[model samples]
Target: MNTFSIKPTICFDTGSIEYLKNIKNKRVCIVTDPFMIKSGAADKITNIFKANKVEYEIFSEIKPDPTVQTVAAGVNKMRTFKPDVIIALGGGSSIDATKSIILFTVKILNASGDEYKKPLFIAIPTTSGTGSEVTSFSVITMGTTKFPLVDDKIIPDIAIIDADFVKTVPPQITADTAMDVLTHAIEAYVSTNNSDYTDALAEKAIKIVFEYLIKAYENGEDLEAREKLHNASCMAGMAFTNASLGINHSIAHTLGGNFHIPHGRANSILLPYVIKYNANLESGEETEAGKRYAKLSKILGLPCSSISEGVKSIIVAIKILMKTTNIPMNLKEVNIDKNDFLNKLESMVNDALNDKCTATNPIKPSKEELTQLFQEIYGE
Candidate 1:
């Protein structure tokens, strides 16, 4: 039997940050990056706590592509602080790191046969990407590998969508994160495990991204565009969390961890190629994934004379969007050394193949095919 679920209580209204004030007589741990604290975004939430007289501590060491070391440290801090509410406030990295911290802390407590009270987990995304706020998956970097930890325990209890926090995001980040939202929706829509529930959410997310991403990217002050994209990001997150993801995320995880590429940018660079690869018709027969792509193309009102043509139109449109946003189309454009990429290509392939996301990929790629795909992405 197939299953679908959405666990988080989403709050997306003006002044949604004020929700934190509800936690009274509790220790709250604010997990975020240094930038959020430095840029005064963290204050937005902290001020609420202060007004409500809620005791709070800030953990601001989370970095981009959060590392195992950082998570372990955060877990230690959480154990010592014994917070009742844990607020993940920032981009995907911070939320992901916070999830790992909570998971590990619980594991440690459970190992000692201690009854651990789970904290109220809240994720407030400052950027409209990753949907990490609502997803049960957390991507953590270990050395040169990204391990995606998936568990229902890691999913947040609450998600706060405040467009005010995203107003200061730079254009490049806006473009990259918007593309990440697109990738999430598209991959979820075409996943082998997709259901009607996920498909509807994914389709709506895709429409929203196409309609509002450019507006948000071109003008960050556009609250209407920001709000729409933020909602789209969370919707895609919910869709993928239920339907799971595909090889696109697996590849992005590997590329980001190994090459120090930003997660969204890595996904953006690989998306078009992945779409084309997944949609390739073998023996002149349409794959289920290809049919899904065709349907999505039709939904978007792209050229759709046939299944193949429809799939090709989606790929073309993605390329045009990437170009318009100034995203790199290949690994070379991002300045990765050709020799280093070649050396690490096999390991990358192996990691991607073993990734949890790969289990739901519509097209199961062979080792040789994966190797070829990497080389092609490298522009060899």
Candidate 2:
């Protein structure tokens, strides 16, 4: 059986953060990184608590690629504070770490068969990326691998998407995350489990990225662009959470975990190559995925009179977008030494094949195919 559901009431537009006031007199705990503290975005949330006389605590220790260790620390904080509400107030790392912390807390607090009621979970994204605010997924790092955990309990109760919070985001981050939004939307649209519901949301997200990602990247203060991208990210999250992802995310998760590259940047670099492999234009074979790519190209107003041409057009368009956004086009550009990548190629292939995401790929890839795709994306 198949079903579609959009969780988390998405809140956006100017003054959306004002909803924090509705949180009442409950004790609130904010999970975020030091950057939010430095940027004063953290204050935006805390200020509301103060005005309403609500008690709160801060956990600003989150870092990029946050590990199980980081999550453990957050769990400790949650245990002591026992907050009535939990607010995740940073980028993907902060939100993901908070989700992990909450999950761990459930295990720890309920270890002796005691019922632990979850706090009111609220997410305020500081970037127009990840869509973590609305998804049941969370990536927690352990050693050299990142675990993508999906659970009903981790989905935020509310996602506040005020663009004012993201006005200070740097250009490169804007580029990286906006491309991530495109990947999420495209992957969801072509997912094996896709339906009319997911397709509608995915199409809207893809259209928004093609139209406004660059505008926001070029000018961070572009409020209209930021708002559009922010909403697009949420919509893409909704689509992917329902439809699931594919090898594009599988390979991305493997490589990003291995190389310590930022997740969104890794996805952006691999997209063009993955799209080609899925389309199978080189083998001159027609496929459902190829047809989907063709439809996407046509939607972008590219040259897509035929499936092959549509495939080529979509690839070219992605390359063009990557160049314009200054995203590295290959592993070399991201400074992944060829020797290191080659040395780990076999394991990465196995990991991608076994990745949870691979189950939903429109086309199942073999070890040889994945290896070749990895080599090809290594670039000149």
Candidate 1 lDDT, tens digit per residue, 238-317?
99999999999999999998898888898989998898889886548888888999998999999999999999899898
The candidate 1 region of ten consecutive residues with least summed lDDT is 13-22
Where model 2 places Cα greater than 4 Å from the true spot, the runs are none
Q: List model 2 lDDT by residue over 1-380, tens digit each.
A: 89988779878897899898788879899999998899788889888888999999999999999999999999999988888899999899999999989988978888958677798899998888799998988988888777889997899999999999888889999989999999999999999999999999999999999899889989888889999999999999999999999998898888878998888899999999899888887777899999999999998899988999998998898888899989999988988899999999998899899988999998899999899999998896
lDDT of each: 0.91, 0.90
| Per-candidate RMSD, Å | 1.0, 1.0
Best candidate per lDDT, number? 1
Off by over 4 Å in 1: none
